[model samples]
Target: MSAAPLTLTVATPLRVWFDAVEIVSLRAEDASGSFGIRPGHADCVTLLAPSVVRWTCTDGTTRYCAVDGGVLLVSRGVRISIACREAISGDSLESLEAGVRSRHAEEDDAARRARVEQLQLHARAVRQMLRYLRPHPGGGADGPDGPGIGANPR
Candidate 1:
């Protein structure tokens, strides 16, 4: 008797990457290093790194995907599911590495820009709050006689 075929699924927060894949074996890399999986193997979980996950398809061809970082769960020694933030399919390993590096750099830049913008927003909000709390002499919004909550409106 032969081993059971794998039921593999790769998913992200947005959508499903691969719903079901039939494979005789799978090769994947994580923080520790690279490892392989065959059907009926021991069930375990891996903290995957930003690397490629490889497997041969049902059509007897190998496939690869670049994953940002995620969890690989091998359940019941038959099912494998990868939960990640992003997944990019690739035709080959070399091409996948190049594309993954480029995309990762772009993502890093975007994240840095977003953090800067968020900090700016927070700073602006704090300044506005301080202005309102300063208690101006005139009867304006920032004035002593203005609508400043908990302040003596003289």
Candidate 2:
């Protein structure tokens, strides 16, 4: 007799990506490495990195999901749950990979822009502070006796 299939549920903060679907097996990656899950496997929890998760259904067709890091929990040796910040699913690995790369590129660009903006803000703040500290253009001491030893103009 064939082993019972496991149920998979994937979700993000916004919505449920995949409801309970019966899958014969599953493959995912974590910091340690890739691992597989099947019915009657040990109940465990793992931290998944940004990688593709693949599973084979009872019909013998495979499906894929790209996750941006998440937590995977296996319960009762038959229930698999994945919670991620972002996830995209497709049957074609090539398309899935392309989509992931595009998403990552957009995120990187946004981060770079944010950093630039933050640096600009800091620069502006420093410039303002320096301007405030500087002596008045026409009134402040231009000679040593006025403000400091070097303030004296020859």
What TM-score would every model get versus the actual structure? Answer: 0.67, 0.76
All models, RMSD in angstroms: 4.5, 4.6
lDDT tens string, model 1, 19-108? 977887888898789999988989999899987899987678888998888999998898999999999887788888888888879989
lDDT against the true structure, each candidate: 0.86, 0.89
**Residue-pair clash count for candidate 2:** 4
lDDT of 2 by residue, 25-134 (tens): 99999999999999999999999999899999989999999998999999999999999999989888988888888888999999999999999999999987665556
- Give the Cα error of residue 130 in candidate 2, in Å: 3.5
TM-score of 1: 0.67
Q: What is the lDDT of residue 45 in candidate 1?
A: 93
Residue pairs clashing in model 1 are none
